[model samples]
Target chain A: MREKLIEFRNVSFRYGEEEPWVLKDVSFDIYKNEWVAIIGHNGSGKSTIAKLMNGLLFPQEGEIYINGQVVNQDTIWDIRKEVGMVFQNPDNQFVGTTVQDDVAFGMENRGIPRDEMIRRIDESLTAVGMQDYRLTEPHRLSGGQKQRVAIASVLAISPQVLILDEATAMLDPKGRLEIMSTVSNVQDRNELSLITITHDLREVVQAERVIVMNEGVIWDEAKPREIFAKKDRLREIGLDVPFIATLADELNKSGLRISNEPLNHEELLEDLWTLHSKM
Target chain B: MDITFKNVDYIYQENSPFAHKAIENLSFHIPSGSFVAVIGHTGSGKSTLIQHLNGLIRPSNGEVHIGDFRLTNDDKPKNMKELRSRVGVVFQYPEHQLFEETVAKDIAFGPENFGVYKRDIEKRIKEIIPAVGLSEELLERSPFELSGGQMRRVAIAGVLAIKPEILVLDEPTAGLDPRGQKEIMEMFYDLHQKENLTTVLVTHSMEDAVKYADHVIILNKGTKYMEGKPEEVLTQQEALNKVQLDVPEMIEFLYAFEKRFGLPIPFKRQSVKQLADEIQHAMKEAGSHE
Candidate 1:
């Protein structure tokens, strides 16, 4: 779809009228059904950017357009309805004791019919791979499970754009994979656009596009391959290059006659096989 | 059970409607002089488990023992004032636990509380300042004014000041940049090795645990689910997946190699590149065999 789900036009935001702008003049766009990752070190204004999308923190200057509607006082609630947020810190975000109860809290606020709410809750939990623990108390579940429940809560609202702000930071490695897979599937199955703000570079491997932010500005933007090309620069921004990226860089340095095109293991293997067969 | 939990149970807000069981029938141990990493997805009762180690809470049904100190599941029976000196527990966001003005004073808090000599407290402050990778100049500065990573080191140094035999750090590296994460863990590793300290590291990063942990402990639903060396625990992908744990990404690649390429790569290779090199060599040897 050519439709732009969200657009920021020189968006600058501040916490208070007199306070310094938390986000300097910034401009970016999220197309419908696209999975875009916003990455930067802490205090690079990543969280502030995520807050802007949901209208949790409004812009002090410039403008943000969500679903073709300007994000402002008159339309903030509607914009939020279209762009739900899942924040970091599992312990702080939990509103209910039991997993089932926590997932239901969102629907309850919306005044969904009791029966429909029950069905939606089940569907959301299953979407995040957390259906088995619906009856368990959320506080008793592992960090990863709690995060899944948090995602389910956001999904239960059935918004068009899902913003996950470092959602996997508290989760262990396996849990991180589960959440990543769930997000990938959510975008595919539900056709919801995603704006994931995370410092975990491992996550960017699967993103459709990557946006690196620095001092509240888009420092770089490209597809995974192109973005990962500047490995040294990425590290300079306090970001990690992929293991594959490092390997490729090393091969280039070591005078290995490997093709420059292979970006992943599968591609590298095919390249090596072709080289060997030709020899 | 080096630190065993036998039919151990903990119910928060007990005797009221809000009552909840944090952990159930949990049993595990921390053998002396071992670096044990406890990997749980967030609420696997990790904090609840560590609290018992220092007699912070009296278990409702089970008993907790740290060396000679024995604790029944019921009743608060602990000479915890003394236990605090033996076992140092660094909670998450330990910086928030800081109160004193200067870094050195904050570190000296623990040793001072234990009624150690003033000279000994001063001695610990000076020695551990560098161990945590902080300069002596930082000793006089206000901890609140320091950067987050530096503040973290100060907090860790504070914990290190008392020089507890058994040190437990819960997600000591959460919210840090990659370099900060690596640095703090390296400090922990250094301290763990240089001193014969019994260390328990609670973390979500499999890479950190697999790299530094001598032993790995997995807690599931407030119970001691599994305990073994890091290598032994990680090889069981099925069990790890059940509790939502993962081997490092590099290790996962090796596991995939064995399943897909029919490669007979052994596990002794240390780093990712080492494993990749081994794979390269094995593939070459296989080609020669063909």
Candidate 2:
């Protein structure tokens, strides 16, 4: 059986008594080494969940468990050690002058040894494919390179869970792809659980499971294919289906045989070729 | 207002050791009331080119003509404020520029600065609120109290309050969600048509360029890499890839289909439904030949 790394039980949160609840009775479980994507429109409470996981915010009712321990004021410090977060706006999160120095910031905060910090900084930089830019300053690098450095800093601490809250929203298309591929490569060699909060459906294709949020509630939870199958419903909820799925649906409507849940271009083309040969 | 750039060059910190040319010999003409998309990667001179449109920066070499205002290194229009009032630039993350206590005041800030009459500013505010998809109820509320998307709309409404003849958008939908992105783009397109405004959009999304732009200019390393109609320029996948860009997904799909079926499907800015119909027709024709 798989282990449950994180759990939220009947959690509800709000900033104050008069403020409306941002998360209402939200419950979910994340397993070890799983990649889950949480998607919602702006102000949909998706970012609230990321903060609640790392104890940045506390629930007004019910409880949250991280690594089989309840999150409380006393345990918050220990819980933070297990959960590392990368937020939106690459410029706001960067602290160090150089690439290597940025990766060492988190480790230095925990009073890690000099030799150990050196080893970890090197390992994390190489993992994100940014080893050659160790001496480069933050302003000199492109948006994509800065994000990679942010990812490496998060990895240097070696947290069990990594939550990226709209991390790629500020980046261009090329920068978005670079961060996505870097996260995939890091996951292949480590047992890290990734929670990506985004509104971009293209990034959702990489997740093992998807959780859709609407109006401060958990609207749906399923695999990527199952979630994308309902194209009109997604559109109604202020989300968009991927381009491949939209094209596949158009083909199906036009008396062509294609799967309604094609995740990528190659799959849709393969299905079309099969149908074409039989015709 | 038509925009023309002739042999323009913009250099940062000119005549110093740190001097670097941001735009080199860039020349393009955007006819009055036409929508143009400037496509490029980061640091590719897209921002520098747009700054010239509103007379924000004088070109180091050559000349720029926007309507009757001509800007060169040696001379600038005496009425620079009037030129600015006619060109509206909705920059990336415009919400950050909001500072007024109420939405109504924030929207009125621009027109007030341009010496617009008080009653005219109020009239523009009323017409702009609903046009940018905002309710009248929020006009009295604090701009900081609104959501990110709402703040962006309010900022855009401020730009429109001046009633500019030309609109420049610098990735106006950068941090918005999918639905918000569509709504904002559609709103801009609607305004572009109704007002007969010349639109210049600097964006990285090839999809947006293909959807809304009649002409596209691709920039690479401070130079014009290519310029033509969207269908003619964007279909060159190899050339775009050289600049660290890709064709839109529709064109990419068509290319893959051509490779798999040994058939060519010309892209004429077709919608998905139209493209599907063409694909269906192509498949039947191939089967009959076999």
Candidate 3:
């Protein structure tokens, strides 16, 4: 059986008594080294799940477990060390003047030894392809580069699970691609559970599994292919399938044989060629 | 307003030790009432280029003509405020600029500052409310109380209230969801048509440029890399990739299809369904020929 890194059991939460519940009875499990993407429209309680996993906010009704330990006041600090989070705005997350200083900031707060901090800083920056930019100031770097630095800082903590909370929303298309590839590389090198909270369907297509959130609830949880198959339903819920999925559906409607869930351009084209040969 | 840039150059901190050129020797003409998309990377001087639209920054070593107003390094239009009243810029994260107590007040602030009549400001608010997908009830609510999408709509409504003839959008759909992005872009397109506004959109999404813009300008290292119709300019895949840009997914797919099936389906900005129809016809014709 796959080891579960994080689990939410019948979680429900609200900010205040008068306020409506932001998340309602949501439950899901993230296994070791799994890349799970949580997608929803704005204010859909998707981001709340990220906050709950690391004990930033406790669920009023249910429990969140991290490596078999329940998250509460006493265990919150320890749970936080196990889960690292990268927020949306790169400008707001910077606490250091230079790239290397920022990566060392997290480790310094944890009171790591100076020699060990230096070693981890170099290792993490190299992991994110930012080793050459160690002395570069945050302002000198591009949005994509700054985000890579942010990822390196998170990696320095050596957390078991990493949560990116709408991390690419403020970046351009190029920056978004850079962060995605960097995260993929880091995951390959480490046994890290990735929870990406985003609205971009392009990024969602790369995930191993997807959890769809709608109106403070778990609308659906499935693989990327299964989730994208219901294109019309996704649209109704204010989410979108990727362009390949939409185009594949169009080709199928025009009496052409194509997979309903082509993940990329090459796959859909290959299916079309197979259909053409028989004709 | 029609815009023309003649050998434009903008140097930040000029003559100082830290001097850097943001835009250099750029020349382009945007005809009156045309839609233009400026495509480039983050530091490719897109923001610097759009700032010249409203006289926010004067060209360091060139000429800029927006309608009757002219700007140069030494000379700017005496009536700078009037030029600003004619150009409305909806910046990235425009909601952060919202400061008024209520949505109605925020929408009225721009027009009121421009000396528009109080009665006319109220009329424009009423007309712009629905144009931005905001309802009448939202006019009384505080802008901070609204959701992210609603706050953005409120911010856009404020820009539209100015009744500017030239509209500049700098990644206006940056943080919106997929559906919200489509709705906002469509609304802007409708307003552009109904008002005959000259629209300049600085965007990273090539899909938006292909769908909405008639003309496209690409910048690389503060220079004009390419400029022409969207179909002609965006199809140069190698040139765009050199600048860290990509063709829209539809065009990319058609290129791959041609390579794989030996079928050439030219992209004329066709919808997905239309492209599928053309592909089906091409396959049938090829089979018959065989």
Candidate 4:
């Protein structure tokens, strides 16, 4: 049987006892090697969902099952090893001055041997295409490079899944693309499950599955095309549709009938060409 | 307006071992009352260029002049407080800069610092708060308690209380959800129209540059790469790509149409709706023969 990597069985959480529940009746199952995008607008409890997966925030109402081990005070420390987290703001996340040192830190905490740690650090850094900059100071790197290092740090630990908490939001367009491209490569090479928590629709265009959150609950969940089909519903929740999807919708509204549900430039071009030739 | 750089050069920590050049021999200008957009790759020195306009950073070897207040390699005072007041600068993540107990106090900080009287500051806050879509009732609450969108407005209000003739925003919509981004951009457009505000915008969104900017200046590797009206800058897509800046996909699509059909269409148009309308008209006109 393909293992149930992470299962959130009707989980709920809040910042404080008096506060309204940030996550209510949330439930989903993430499988091995699936790249899932948790889509939401600001204050939608998407970040809280991620925190719960990594054991940073324990669910208040229900339980989180990681590899069939329930996440609780007793098993959280063990669960953290199975789910690695890469937070936003790489500047704040760097615990080490140099890139190599940062990548080695998590392994060091795990009591891995010095030589094995060194080998894995190199492997992870190279996997993220940041081996050349391993000796460079983390602070001196750009946002994208810093984020790659952050990913490398997590990858060194070799968790079954990596949670990126809006890790690409703050970067410039070029930087964002670089980070996403690197992440895509790593996901393919390592077959690591990815849970990207973000509002940027562009970042999640090719995700295997998408779970859209609204006001602490799953508003809708579907495959990328199926989910993006509800363009108006998505926009109503203060989220922009993927650019190509947006273009297709606008074209449809204007009577320029396009057939394909394109989420990107190349696909949009292909669809438009078919329509133009048919005309 | 007309912010010509004129061989402007700026160095960070000059004469020290850690000395680095930020902007080197750069030159450009934003005409008065015209919205100019600045785009550049990271470390291309656009931030330094913006700071130069307000005298926040002085050139190490060249000079920069704003209307009358000038900055040179060797001249001008240490404090350009007057210059700063007239040129309202809204920073990226301006919400993070908010530190007042109340929104009104936060907005009042800039004017009060510049010796604007209490009554005038109150009047200024009242005038602009609504413009930013924040009501007066929300003014007494802690600035931190407001939503990110509202907090950004408070920060903008802080800058607007100074009654600047020119507004320079460095990625005002960065880190905002698309809805929040649209809200802020529309608010800026409104402010620019209602007050005749001369706006210099630094943005990563080529769509925003084409949508709002009358003129566009592009920098690459700390030097001027291109400068023209939006139509002029966007027409040369290859140069923009070379500098790692994205052109609006719609604009690219329109250009492809002209290339394929040899259609005498204006490809510089940015609006997708406008392009679609033009395409239908052309098609229907041609199909009349069929």
C-alpha lDDT score of every prediction, in listed order: 0.80, 0.93, 0.93, 0.84
How far residue B194's Cα lies from its native spot in candidate 2, in Å, is 0.3
Cα shift from native, residue A271, model 3 (Å): 0.5
Each prediction's DockQ against the real complex:
0.27, 0.80, 0.86, 0.50
In model 4, how large is the Cα lDDT of residue B72?
88
Instruction: Output DockQ, candidate 2.
Output: 0.80
Model 1 DockQ, alpha carbons vs. true complex = 0.27
The digit string of per-residue lDDT tens for model 3 on A31-108 reads: 999999999998899888999999889999999999999999999889988999999999999999999999999999
Ranking by DockQ: 3, 2, 4, 1
Supply the TM-score for candidate 3: 0.99
Better of 3 and 4 by lDDT: 3
A77-141, model 4: which lDDT tens digit per residue? 78888899988787899988789988888888999899999899989999988989978997699
Q: Which prediction has more favorable DockQ, 1 or 2? A: 2
Name the top DockQ candidate. Answer: 3
lDDT for position A84 in model 2: 88
| Stretch of 10 with least lDDT, candidate 2 chain A | A254-263
lDDT of 4: 0.84
- Model 3, span B1-290: residue lDDT tens: 89999999999999999999999999999999999999998888999999999999999999999999999999999999999999999998999999999999999999999999999999999899988998999889999999999999999999999999999999999988889999999999999999999999999999999999999999888989999999999998888888789999899998898998899999899999999899999999998899
DockQ winner, 1 or 3? 3
Local accuracy of candidate 4 as per-residue lDDT tens digits, B1-290: 45667788888998999999888888776667889899888899989888887887788987787877788878985558888888999988888899889888889999998999999888888899898889999999999877677888889889888999899999998767778889899999988988898999999888888889988988888988998988888778798888787777667766666665556567665356666677666755655655
Summarize candidate 1's per-residue lDDT along A129-214 as a digit string, tens digits: 99888889865676777888988998998999999988887776767777888888888899699988887876876789998887
